[model samples]
Target: MGIAEERITRLHQLAHEATASGDFDLAREYVRLARRVAERNRCGLPKSFRRFICDECDAYLRPGVNARFRTQSGGHVVVRCDCGATKRYPY
Candidate 1:
């Protein structure tokens, strides 16, 4: 990983820690900053990091708190956010 990727990884870790501590708002801010860093540096968030955030509400999903994970038919994975937004990924 290069410098930008390293920075992005660090930011994602911070967001995870913030969410774990029940400071969701802080986590959201961290995600926003991470995105900006990625954009400025011409990179994207790692695939694993992308799945932890709700695209609609920018919420950090804790897998049963603010988000629900379901396995759909045909090898699809569904993530439903508390904001009523759903994302389906074919895994």
Candidate 2:
């Protein structure tokens, strides 16, 4: 993988660790930095990275921690961030 992609992945790992340790601010910073790197390198954020970040608040999500996950009858999964931003994706 390219340097930018590798860096983004590393940042993703750091964010996950930070969140797990309850350092949410650090995780948010990591997410922001990853996005900046992706933008500068003209590379799209990885799919998993995009899905795990809150588009409205820029927070790294950890399922039940600061976000909620639910399945709907509409045949899609919903992710609601603590900031109340909702995202839906097909299963």
lDDT of 1 by residue, 1-91 (tens): 8988998898889999999999999999989988888899988888899988888878878897778999988999999988999998888
Instruction: List residue ranges in candidate 2 displaced over 4 A.
Output: none
Q: What is the C-alpha lDDT of each candidate?
A: 0.89, 0.96
RMSD of each predicted structure: 1.0, 0.6
Q: What are the models' TM-scores? A: 0.93, 0.97
Clashing pairs in 1: none
Separately for all candidates shown, the number of backbone clashes (residues 3 or more apart, or on different chains) is: 0, 0
lDDT of 2 at 88: 96
Tens digit of per-residue lDDT, candidate 2, span 6-85: 99999999999999999999999999999999999999999999999999889999888999999999899999999999
